[model samples]
Target: MINTWPKNGRALYTRETVITAIRKTITAVGCVAALTAGAVACGTEQQLSPGKQLSNAFDAMGKQHSLSVEMGLDATPDQLIAMSKGSDEPMPPAMAKAMSKLKVTFSAQSKKALADTEQGDVTGSSMKISGGEGDLVEGRFIGDTVYYRVDLKAFAKMTGSPAPTKEDLDAKLPKGLGFADKILDGEWVKVDTKAMKKAAEKQSKANGGSGVTGGKDGKDGKDGKTPSGKPTLSEQSQKKILEELKGVVNHEVTIKDGGKHDGADHVVATAPFRTVLKSVFDKLRPFADEMSPGGAAKMPKEEDFKEIPDAKVSVDFALKKGKLSAASMDLAPLAEKAKIKGEVPLRMTFDDSADNVTAPANATAIDPEEMIAGAMSLASGARGATGHGGVHGADTSLYTG
Candidate 1:
């Protein structure tokens, strides 16, 4: 139904955002490679340099009709806690005990071609946060809607909060009556992005906002401006980003042959931890400045990142029968800044996912305004309950997939 996973929206810090960062990083590398892929003298795939091979593999995955990516944490909860905390000192006993109960595995299936990242493109993805008994939370993105639900008791246990009883829902659902029990059962909820967009546009207009409202035509605008007036990355911005990232990709990121993994040919892409981040930031500063003329980029200074040592961050891409099958990255380097030392591996596997990413049937759709109304009703002692079937958005950020 509606995406109500703990708003952090990830099982591990590594699953979505980290993988997104990795994808963006690698996509920049592939962009630069695409520029040269045609011009370079053709050669056998085996003869290509590590960087070129990686670029080609990344490109090949992008060219697929549709793809799926599965990412998971291979470390124990204790290790995850240490890496997450980034502290040299031991975690408080209570905190460690509580965190250790979590399940860090997550999977996502998507229908978009990797390189077809243009705005307004219709892509679908589904994610599940695995738990010992079942999924703690899950969500699916189908076109302009997202469906999500959480196991109330499991989520409550994970967060160390009391599970919302049907009574809790009844308290807010004076008009809806005994409907809270069914909702608390974790029925799917969907949020219509189109509706959200319309509401946002109306609210923006009411507030005297001048930005273009995004829809079919306004998704991508001139000068990297989106409908919200926020800078949407343009091809040129990507080019600038690629220019900054190309050097490290070529010189620092190395690819080596790993004989076999999961019955597939594996290729490793390695780079220095601090080197890539610094270079990425350094090159991005000018373009970030260009976006909002005269304002300094809010990116961190070099000195601010001194905690991260120049450790190697290796990403392994797997090819099965010459097709991209899976990929994984070691996340230990990121945790080193926290004074934690150990391997924190996150693996992502790919597949054909077009037929699999369908929207769920019978999802209860709720608008954001209804959510606001519901919240106000709760605060006002539920006397002013709306006539609608009330289901407020769930704040399930502790484990988002």
Candidate 2:
């Protein structure tokens, strides 16, 4: 077996390294929490209107201490192609193939009783670009730690790394990174959340302050300071934008099937693509001008916006037991823009019966820095082995000459 520690007695992992490895995961969960919080703040009033009822559902959802979320997306090949047309960068052939076969689904159940305490489990799978089915990865979060159970063979294949052995991990990894011993033994890898939080705080301080607030000039009123130093939307501004949207988009409300859906309410909203786009652009013109090269002179014309074919966006909301149970958005206009034959739909549903999340048992804690160092070591070893020499001997002629 490889030695876990080196002679230097220095730790291999650092707060920064661990934070970077899991930042994306944290952001994803944070977004869900933010959305729930927004709904609660926006819909706390007692009202019976259809819109108010929808808002009330969101409020209830926000109040739940624990809930489950399921999200899914399915795109046909044509729809995928249409989606790719929006990207400025060219998609590699392999990636394009993977996108064509893409079918993504994920679900999580989370609970938070205190600001410092939270827990959840996430699981998901996608179709592989190759002919085989993709492996499902599962993770559990408790307190400030996350434990992941991954299929080693599939992980190696996806990452283009050799299947890691216990010896390799022990020898190559630093003591902090050696948390992989459990993973090598076919168990989960534990990540330290406290370290991640510390790193995040350090990063914020280094970047000049908490990223959530603006300078003394009130550049960021609330919601958080944006990089552009522009003012965030105020409630008054938001209401005005909603009014504009109302003028452009049609709204409808209907009682959904009472028997099948447990007496839930449904709200359907639709808007003409061109009209909505124009209204949005008009609202954003000031900001765009500030950021654009030629300012107001280069502002896009209404005529230019009119080039898009007239199509519609449909958003559906379902409320049950005074809580938002499900929501969906369909943007069919973009398909027409790309001259494709299908629509891409996104959907999410909430379940409030989730049990409290718990940390995985017997998980080995690993330092983030150690994992990174181990990967680098493996890569370096591979490169050295492939140098311009046969296994039998090195050619001295090139170096001497």
Candidate 3:
């Protein structure tokens, strides 16, 4: 049989992106922990090491709990602007004269994960954003990866109109595709740092960082000019550069302290939240600036991000057998009145084969790209029919594990 998933390509998103999802997944998984934490405290005598407890609790929960979670997303201004620019035909004078409009919403769901090994179900929604309504998108996660669906019509509806199918959607696919896929797969590509280093070095020298004789800090000047006819960095300046470089390169992360979250002690893992976006932009900016009508599209670098300050995930339970019973969980997104609101619902159940089993079969590897494309197409159509806008406004569903 054709593998249900692919095997050899890099995952669509980076570690950080996956981690973000994991953190979000925790909201739903937390419910199981909430109950189990109490049981765990009662079962253990000497204070358990926070880190060990985290490992142990998750282990237990994984064996016994499964949860259902959902989330909502709101589009950034850039996405809305891009959407409004899409059209089925070249704008006529009258239509061209009218300003384009757009808006958006986003969200997702996952069946039981962190709570238990018994597989569970998760479903959620998304929509195309515009001034009126948004498109709809949704998903289900059974094992290691998620299966998502999206509605494009709802996206079109956000602008107070029906979204065109096929052709019109295809026209807008190129630019919107990447963002859509990234959102669906919840990942971004890694950058080639080696290339970035070369670019950075060339740019630095071009900006007058070459050393020469009789320079302000180095060798004698030739014809009253440095070898590259540019000024070099002073020893202090270079030292400062080196110091700053050390901070970002090859930094190590370790958990040194344990803290309380949701009324229980847990280990804290810390690391730099770097991304490939920085390096990609760094290498391309020069070329983009030198050519093209777009005038070097301004892309945000990873460093431009501000730390979220309090993002965290906690382990409350561990199910050793991967057969969750009496497991309970409620991710905030899933708690919305539109979804399941009372007494955390039993969302999914998994077979023992999926529990604590590392290494999902390489043969069944998921194609994040395919998953994204399928989801966007589905979202486009769903939006058109429902007049919804984006994932945030889409309907939620329960599924079998």
Prediction RMSDs, each to the true structure: 8.3, 12.1, 19.5
- Residue-level lDDT of model 3, residues 1-401, one tens digit each, is 00011133211222122224335434434423432333333333333354355446445545432232222223233322332233222222222112122222232233554443222343322222223323233333333333333443433233223333343334334344444433333232222333434444454456575432234554434443333223334566555544433333223222323444444343433322222223324444544423322335555445554322222222222223222222222222232222222332222222333222122122223334443444455555445423443233322101000
Candidate number of the best TM-score: 1
Q: lDDT per prediction?
A: 0.54, 0.46, 0.33
lDDT of 2 by residue, 1-401 (tens): 11112334322222122223234223322333333233323332321345466556666765655566654444454565555575443333333333333222333343343222333322211111121226335676555667776555543443322455665455443456545666655577777867754554455557667532344563543544333254355666667655543333322112222223546676554445555556656765665534532345556688887555456555566777677787655544544546556555555677776655566577777765455455555544434334553122321110011
Put down candidate 1 lDDT per residue, 345-368, tens digits, no spaces: 666566654455677778787765
Question: Model 2 Cα displacement at 259 (Å)?
Answer: 14
Give the range where candidate 1 is weakest over 10 consecutive residues by summed lDDT: 382-391
Candidate order by decreasing TM-score:
1, 2, 3
TM-score of each: 0.66, 0.50, 0.25
Predicted structure with the largest lDDT when compared to the true one: 1
lDDT of 3: 0.33
